[model samples]
Target: MTANPLADDITQAAACLGGDGLLAGEVQGFAARPQQQEMAAAVEQALTDASTLIVEAGTGTGKTYAYLVPALLSGKKIIISTGTRHLQDQLFHRDLPTVRSALGVPLKAALLKGRANYLCHQRLHMTRSEGRLGDRRQANQLEQVFDWSGRTASGDIAELSNIPEDAFIWPRVTSTTENCLGSECDWFSDCHVMKARREAQDADLVVINHHLLCADMALKEEGFGELLPGAEAFIIDEAHQLPETASRFFGMALSSRQLLELAQDAINEYVGETGELDGLPDVARELEKATREFRLEMGQGEQRAPWSRLDGNPALTEAREALKTALADLAIQLEPLSERSRGLDNCYQRALRVQTLLAQTTEQPPADYIHWFETWRQSFRINLTPLDVSENFNSQRHALPDCWVFTSATLSVNDSFSHFAHKLGLEDATTLQLDSPFDYANNALFYVPKGMPEPSSPDYTRHMLDETEAIIEAARGRTFVLFTSYRAMNLARERLRDSCQFPLLVQGDAPRNELLERFRELGNAVLLGTSSFWEGVDVRGEALSCVIIDKLPFASPGDPVWQARIDAMKEGGGNPFMDEQLPHAVITLKQGVGRLIRDMNDRGVLVICDPRLLGKRYGRVFLNSLPDMGRTRDLDDVVKFFHASDALSL
Candidate 1:
């Protein structure tokens, strides 16, 4: 194939860095894969052509540099949106610096995270003075934070991983839009969030997470200015997650914990002790009691009842009213303290949201969305999300005439982009599918066990677990058994725990990256996980030689949102299973299968325990979606394939 002009430019750019001159300058001289070159071309073209572009560059593609290079070279203000905060930091701190240094480009780049990551000095001082440190544990955490703050130049909370993300101390230490005193605060001039924004405003490249990007798209903050002002282009990596993230930004949600936090914060302002709310623990106890009574009175016999049933309960009505009155009383008591403590502003705002949520839930909701209540051990949550995110995303895209680029490794089915394109409302957008340079034929085997029950069968989970155990034995424990449901994952974990000869690690055992680190360190550990593990996991060489998918990841029809979407599609003369569900499953399955081959010599076995793939008519669609692995039913062949390859080397 003739090299495109942008590709030629990238080639010359790589040549400037010396070495093999094939864009091989990786982070610390790690060789750049050929797929990275292809991705770089697509990104460069998207910039030059000024049109929407979608490309799927698989694992081991080194796609970070691919897009980063063109973005820096174009010298245009660009917003590079990532799926996670981890990647956002990596791109800004590590990848961007290396690429800019190697390519001899002196482009300024800034990393901006969501509002919650930055410390709110206004809230911090208020919390400290109000005696809101609560307990010795919190006080110690605060002391450590205070010491860290003095030394911290960036004021990014992520710098302190010792503190859990969900720590109660964070809400007290961090600033929110509602609670931020702005110029009134002593630290406003030195605010980390504002500093990051200022840097983003001046830089040619800005890195942000999807949530922040979507928030900017949906909320349109004025004082802080647009996130991508002066930006001519946008690149969203891990693009599959955009639809869900956009939906969350567009929708509304309220949880009991949020309400309680508000009540506690307000109470702290009034009582001058954070633990003073603890003295009123009876209030929480009463709330839980009333919630349970309300649920029982509502005829929600089972733990999981349709949200529609929430309105029928008179007890719920009474409970909600009682909660509202309590919150309002708390808010009234804190009104005077808001002047003294900026933290009280957040409490007041939260109370207002709770009151509003109660009102909205009582009223008839919009037909486009589904309202639901999720009951947990100690709390209840009310959620309202659009049944389909496509419409909202479509509206947003139409509103902006700016060029867009969405890329992921698994955006297509059998080389067709119709599913993802339709879902994202990009029907007319240009699309490309860059095949991974890894040779799957030599590197992997697709193992579909014979005579397994259909995925829908009652015994399917048990059978799948049994078969998975056998394969794990053969592979000698370098495995990732991915399940579609938590139920199956639990069952598999229970049944295989003692039987398996290797050390077993499940998803919940630790955070994903930590688990991966352990798994790689052990070298032959078996890790079992669900949806998150299906994609965005990079275990390139050893430590992962077998990937067993429980079944095709079809959205459960019984799921409230999925059911609503299916009905909506049916009304529009669309086959939800084919147009919506199948392609989604294809992309998901592609992600699971793509985990196997991360390098040219990397080898593994992809075993789909679900017989439906071979038995059902739609199976070919999923099969075709995968790379050309030598399909087989024999267990022995998979063992032979693994033994023959160098992937098993210690």
Candidate 2:
């Protein structure tokens, strides 16, 4: 047998991460961790052999540096994907530089986000000339963006922090795949999206979020050109989120917002370029009215339901027909005007795409897809999600590169990676699990409160809040009360508002980052939040001392997409609860419990108020999946633990 030549790099990579090595001499207070070094060796081996590797490095494992050192040493053109845009920024602007500088490697890097993140010069100009603002405030916001456009070089909206990311004005000033005129755009020379992609193509390393990666995968599936440059290796930082994100992009979606935007754009183009002929403006206005009427028929409040729910309702049926007719009328009117200008041509193509998706949605869905609709306050989305994305995701992975590394903190359940592997059809990949180097055994306490009602009971939130109040008081209000549902979080907020004394911060009262900043600054505030707060949150030192979970984080049976998958699993001769639901819940619970004990010196109590943790048979799966902390059922033990910490602090 021939010896592998690149195997020497594994040892070199591990040595560089070791004590008395390059990093130890460069970074201050950088303690050498055995787990991080082991992970770096495994990543190096994967890169050398051009194979697949999965690693679940627990919290505080320094996974970022572990994968990065090997990637830089290999000198391969690499693409690193993160779970969120904020993480992308952190890795590109902060972590990447630290590692590259420590290794003294001169690798060029780039940060690429989706097109929507960059401001579109053409759209900004059209929005300014159209003068169709909703109010005076929107007009002022447009002027602010316009003024900043000249001074900015990158055109990334994140650079302008005066306007919120979710402000209504952003949609008017940005572009999407549907509305963006590729090379025909007037501002093609100065396009921010193109500029970012060009940099990514030229750099040796590119950092992007999951959305852009999946978008490239879906585009390739459609035989379109790739959005990303070819790379020798792809390292997914938060691999646990890949399957879900891939499923979304692999499927199809048509939104009411897209339809309304097409209508408005068509009217604007007609006024600017085309003559007032054939009642084109009137037809576009009809589409606007039909879209709003259809939204009204979806009923009040946010909701998600299977498309079959519209089978028997006559009003919904009529509204859908009106929407379809309005779209067809607009398409017919714009087909002739497409040659008038590039903007009209883009609108015509968008209208046809929406028409096709609408027709497919109203028909009998394919056997392998779940047809569902979701609605919010002002918009709705009709989605066709695949029942199993294993085949599709596997194909995309194979097409990408010879080497792949999928690493995350919560990718395994009960110390096994089978569930995650099966989701993405990565059964052949090598797997490794590295426990956190933090002192969880000595610093953290896992408390499952006694006398808790069933999670489904009407009085569950009331009782859970009643118990959490005492713990918050004992911990001096440095607590995060994480819930599985908005209903529960809101109820806890309402009850605590009257009884608790500390500063209360709720999720909807402000933005997520804003709420987190307040929680840290107050030093003694109780923060209530839902699923978004479970993971991707960091609080160290004495600021955060307790975490209270209302229940096991399980997929709700009421969700249409989840229910469809559960039913499909049953039909395929699988135990829906055991094979699917239980494993998913175990992984999610691990992420929630991971909020505490971020550092070696951090000490806190983890409170699971769900009685099922002790009452059900599968509860052991969840408990075993979490870190090996001291477990207790007594409330007095928690109070005493906090009291001991307070004395030590003094």
Candidate 3:
């Protein structure tokens, strides 16, 4: 006779992980893994004790199901948050359902995205009432969304697969916190966002992303139904991204794009509300003009300068004052008009929010902050980012008396969770590390080329191109040449443009998803990318066999944020390089390397061309952090691994 799976017995949790209990004949191709069972047991224990748990479940530990099975069967309200919406969707729509069916647990699960994702019925009505938002392409895109809004059960913009989310028209028809009418919205009765939140409020489980989690923590910004106070367990997937993302939310930011959008939203609201522009449209236009001129005055390209820089420079100070005055003037004009339209009232609130944000950005950086301004992609942004968000994170952690579980494939480096734990204020949490189940000795090779110069050398790109091309030849074009910067990625892409025979897919040539699809379809292709490609990407099989990292993934010293963190770490009797930077880089590198051997049958070569990884003493940390793949310097060994992988694929 089997014991109750819901009991606090860890053995029962272990049994459910097997094929005989809840998983009996329900999980196809089930292979019982001890490491998975161990992690599951740990999660179950944490839930029972209502304690915090930090789990570094390496690739192939089946960590998702390990935690989910216990959480669902516990019959407690659990909130699972991931670093990205893509992973959130996977857990809620795919993995959770699979586990729930097998366990036969009577659990209610809900998927809640940030408000920007859900269609604002109020905004949609306004968009229709005010026609032709942009060019013909944008018009067509809006028409498609208009059609999708009618049929989408979830009202998630992700449902409209044909139109890209970054389309210029999407913002005109979406609501931001600044612009949302909240309960005052005429369409509040049928609000998709509120409805989704209501589901989460009533659910046994809710899956959300890090941004929303952080937002909810800092300000109850989402108001997406209270989380920590209600859920019995908090499980954070891809926990490595939590600290940095939390830092962003805890900081202050004001973008020209956001102000411009506010201005535009105001214009749309005026037209939609009174069915006439009537002097209000001119106020928004003037503010936009001042904003554009201000952006130009901030200068060309990405520039990060201190508040002192802005104070001393006449052009910057003038631009700053002009923009500030314009925003205030815009608010003044909106006061009377706000009474005319509730939409205008929303826009009025948006202007005031921007004013507050701009003021926050211009102020002196608080004790643990780094402030700067930068222009990227033709938009100027000002930021005052926190040097540490641990305190803020801990506050959220204590908001409810519940178990907290942090799990990721690459959270710990050198079998130590101090770096990840301290970063997220989880120093006292229980930590566990599980290695990949795959036999990396036979399936993968960790190769480092002999006698390579430092990455700082001018000849780095040329040498990297030479060595990467050779590796691609050995792998027969199933390669991902990961770079540390855009300069290197573009340099290698240009050099390999004509030399390679296989389809050469560059990162910016198309959308990341499209690039991966093309790489898979081509079966043998070389894709070159920078930071964005390093993580959250999964390509199983021989289509991706060789991963060639150009350099040790280091945070650039030039970044104002990195500089502030280094200073902060130094102030606390710590070696910033050893304590903060190195561990972070090792985790990132592990993520890149883990891409090679995804499944049990998968086989590949991971060639890191950075020689500093061999010369530097701290490089031992990275070496120790990666999977225990068979090490080799011989190019022929890479050739052999690729041949074996290719044969297996065939």
Candidate 4:
């Protein structure tokens, strides 16, 4: 009788993980962790049993491999989705190869990004034929991409190392669903997007981010969007972000950029398909002019309004009517060539979508949705955002595979998965909670200054800066002063610049990756950042010793969608503040605190200046949710701890 080979392989893989592992004999600095092994076993079981598992493995738990090992060993095809592209690129390019080598499994894997990430050869050719862009910089950048386009095999814009991600030229060279001519394009034979999709469809494991997964699920009717139809299992790492990201996918939005882009494409396609009819350019100009007038009336820089405010404006009404009239005329002109060219068909389809969205914005939304308008400098967008995505999200069982696993360190609030489970509509899933293996008692201190002003107080920022001085000095500037708002961050940047000798790195000084790299090299720099810095950021050692949070991470009440949801909850006799807001803030705060104490040997100070955590009744939620560490009120204890660490280092 032959024993099961997978059983031995699993055991061998487990053994090879830490000090006793086979790799340890060949490599240096490997220590076996019981948490990793335990998690791997649980993951294996979850995959085998076809059960939904929500596991919270804390920092230093070796979570990536914990799930990846079981996923690789299952032999069943799985789609592992992460919250960020950096993690997606890491797993597909780095981590998966190492795991496959360790386990000796040759399972196939591929990385799939959205269509916009790939360069469209047809679009590049079209841009070149259209002549130089007005600006010298724009024309030069276009020429640079033209040269690089010939050399890039993958056609990934990310490979353009010299260019910034926000480069204006990327939009002109990349393909969007609205402008892509599909099989009718001349470059169809060598399309990068189609080739990537072929790899994804053929591989046993497909690595994707949350946005792509949501798109695949949302756009199932499109043939290429059927990326998940054949997979046997699903694993969503960083499951806490899934619910929020899912909302954006489930919602409907029509931006003025979409309108203008469609208008521009209509003009170009009309010329390509039929050599420029007399009225074609005029039709496109009318649409663009309407958008400009609409935006002019909307006012700008950043503002959100309920549908009533936008709909009530006479200029906006006149602009929408003018846009509708222009689109109707454009459709009439393009009707003759729509059958001859897929490009014209695509433009007509976009026109239809724009018309439908324009008409729908004036109508009352369904009871479960909130209709709102937002404005930026160049565009005004109307959105039919879902107030409650649970029902819509839960109805996606048809889109998912049988085996499901959702894992993250911050999924649970107050040591239970109720909040995450309820938010994501995953009620009956099996739950597991694993605390961090770090000795936080000895390695970390939680400092809340005594007699701090409340967050709502006008003097809060000034007072918080006063409290921050001691801790910043104690850690000797290895600090991340995280803020809930740009207002707080800017204020801190202003006050702290004069108050301290330590160099300060503000969020917008450079890109996030550049800033993080600079922070590590600077050694004693105090980095002030908000939202994006809180999660998916890892800095090991004393480089990031302290994390100071300005306030609880509550969603702004002024947010149209948030306010609508809050109103709905109130009407239904639920406390939106307690049920929805608190749990969310707890999870977010956990992510911010997580930046400190990243690895087993790392040490840091966590100073939260928000008085709500001490003065309010709901503060207990935060206190209970955070990792248990040594607590302090006096500044001397922090200084002494730093002194002791410095002495030990000497």
Clashes of each: 0, 0, 0, 1
Say which candidate scores most in TM-score.
Answer: 2
* Candidate 4 per-residue lDDT over residues 493-549, each given as its tens digit: 888889888989999989999999999999999999999999999999888989999
Ranking by TM-score: 2, 3, 4, 1
The better-scoring model by TM-score among 1 and 3 is 3
Greater TM-score among 2 and 3 belongs to 2
State the displacement of the C-alpha of residue 305, model 4, in Å, after optimal TM-score superposition: 3.6
Candidate 1 TM-score, true structure as reference = 0.90
Point to the candidate with the largest lDDT: 2
lDDT of 1: 0.75
Candidate 1 residue runs with Cα over 4 Å from true position: 1-22, 25-34, 129-139, 220-224, 271-306, 328-350, 398-401, 646-650
lDDT of each: 0.75, 0.88, 0.84, 0.83
Model 2, runs deviating above 4 Å? 1-10, 220-229, 275-278
Candidate 1 lDDT over residue span 129-204, tens digit each: 7675668989988877777878887889999888777787998888766556566667889888788788888888
C-alpha RMSD in Å of predicted model 2 compared with the true structure: 2.6
Q: Candidate 3 at 200: error in angstroms?
A: 0.8
Which stretches of candidate 4 lie above 4 Å from their native place?
1-18, 22-28, 132-134, 220-224, 274-278
TM-score of each: 0.90, 0.97, 0.96, 0.95
Cα lDDT tens digits for candidate 2, 20-72: 88888778888888888888998999999999889999999999999999999
